[model samples]
Target: MRLSNRNNKPLFSFIYSLVGIIFILGVIAYVLEISKFDVFGKKAWILLAIPSLLFLLLYILGRPVFEYDSDGEALNFRNNHILYILARKDAKDEFPKYKLLKFNIINVFVFKRLYVYILSKKNHIVILKYDINYLSKKQIKDLKFSLNKVVKANKEIRHEHEDNTVAV
Candidate 1:
């Protein structure tokens, strides 16, 4: 299935946390002004503002958009109108590409931010993340099976095609 930033909890948590922090800072500033405290100078103020500003910028830009098949055979990534497709086969199960260079999975968290990396023989690399990518225990197992199947099938096909003299 396709996944995007909409309805993602991590993005919401980030935005809300940033706003909350800024609000807390504002309260502290008001309190300091009320107390007439000069202990924290301009440098301290600048340091405090930097993180909030960066978080605001991130919130404005929004989260990255991601799209992938639930079965893990194909993927499409779109950012700023640049679409990248990382598919090794068509619907007919034919090898559209010569070889898949490498496929790696990196776990960022137990239930969030799963990383999938794809490299092709033509020097193409696709890095995808399932940010806030949560699934049930059963769904996770299914996804694992699908991913393993795709990787194994593609590797065997690539090796067989590279070695023509070997009999079927």
Candidate 2:
């Protein structure tokens, strides 16, 4: 199964465009003599500051697109921002199902993340994180369901191995 929120790109773009247009219209109105409000002249800085602050707020709250693929023998997870320049390095991880140890989903404020724990070839535990802030509640539920299945399977497999092994 593959889950992704790439379709939201156009929606976000539209929102950004609308905000920009509103700011431009405010500037145009201020320049025209038709303006009578003192706020536009005496407090004109508010007009500029409002839009600038809005843009900054939106950028800070925006989250990267996330994808999870579990169709093949390995689980693939990817996180990348639509605007790559402001975003951190993209995160991508693929590991065999059998190596999965545990997984966790953490939510702090408006941000959400998925932490996948895997056993490395050197017998060390490796943790991979993927940003999942933009995912809907239903999508998050489905993700938890899928990861739970893997966790349960891993636990059973380990139990069988322990039972079959001889005392050291």
Candidate 3:
């Protein structure tokens, strides 16, 4: 199965553009005396500060475009800022299914992360993290279902192997 937020690009773009326009209009209104309100005359800084703060807040909390694929023997995941190069945080990873030991989902405030535990060739446990903030509730459920299947299969196989081995 494959999941992605690529189809929501237009909605994201519209929100960004709306915020930008609000900021520009606020600046113009303050400079051109378009409003007769006393706040604009005496506390003009409010106009500048409000929109600036809003843009910064949105940037910090903005969701990234996310993708997950579990089509073959490996699971693939990716995350890139919806605004593209404006934010340089992008991640991509692929790991085989057989090595997967377990997985976890962490949600705090507006942020979410998926932690995958895998067994390395050297018998060390490796932890992989992926951003899952952009995924919807249903998408997250689906992802959890997929990971659970793999982890369960891995555990059952290990148990079968253990049952076949005898103490020497």
Candidate 4:
């Protein structure tokens, strides 16, 4: 899916911007606290340091963006960089689009708080997340439609295979 500018996210942008402002102020406070002046008290360290640490955590993991393609769904999980296909356990189809043919066309869907990565039969399976507020109303609906259609197809095809099951 197309991701607009990061600054367009209202709450996310506000929180990140607040974190930056707090961090800069915290640095200034630390310098003042250790300077030759008595402007900052011992309690200044606790006050500034505590919230700064908390907000730093928020700044790091609060917003995540995923890019999907035939290669794999890409994301930074923790400190590890990951890119791979996770086939669905329930779908027993062995062929599973054995080539990169499906990778050329990847679909993005929005469900509740999720960014569904509907990567056709060949690209394996993946899903994702991001705020819809960063997109227009039309974009949101289009994403939702794409995801729902793929999910429905997944159900029908999987069910058909199940009914034709054979014993080894």
On the 0 to 100 scale, the lDDT of residue 118 in model 4 is 39
TM-score, per-candidate, Cα-based: 0.44, 0.76, 0.76, 0.42
Candidate 3 worst ten-residue window by lDDT: 32-41
lDDT of 4 by residue, 1-168 (tens): 333333344664566667678778777777777785556566568647766786655533323232222122332211111111211111111122221121122234522233334355555665433333334566546555544544565677666777878431
Write model 1 residue lDDT over 1-168, tens digit each, in one string.
443343455664565566667757766775675468666655446544765676554444333333345334444432221112212222212122223333444444433444455664566775544432334455455555655666677789877877875764
Winner of 2 and 3 under lDDT: 3
**CA deviation > 4 Å runs, candidate 1:** 1-5, 9-65, 70-73, 78-101, 108-145, 163-168
Per-residue lDDT tens digits for candidate 2, residues 1-168, read 788988897886677777778778767666652356565557676666677777675666555588898887888898876665447678878888889899898898876888899999999999988878789999999988888888798899999889889544
Q: Candidate 3: count the clashes.
A: 0
- Candidate closer to the true structure by TM-score (higher is better), 1 or 2: 2
User: Which has the higher TM-score value, candidate number 3 or candidate number 4?
Assistant: 3
- Model 2 scores worst on lDDT over the 10 consecutive residues at 32-41
Top candidate on lDDT is 3
lDDT on C-alpha atoms for all candidate structures: 0.48, 0.79, 0.81, 0.42
- The candidate, 2 or 4, that scores higher on TM-score is 2
Comparing 2 and 4 by lDDT, which wins? 2
Query: At residue 111, what lDDT does model 1 achieve?
Result: 31
Candidate 3 lDDT over 1-168, as tens digits, reads 888887887887887888889899879877765456554566777778888887886666545677888899998878777675456567787888889999999998877888889899999999877777768899999999988998999999988888888432
RMSD of each: 8.6, 3.8, 3.4, 10.5
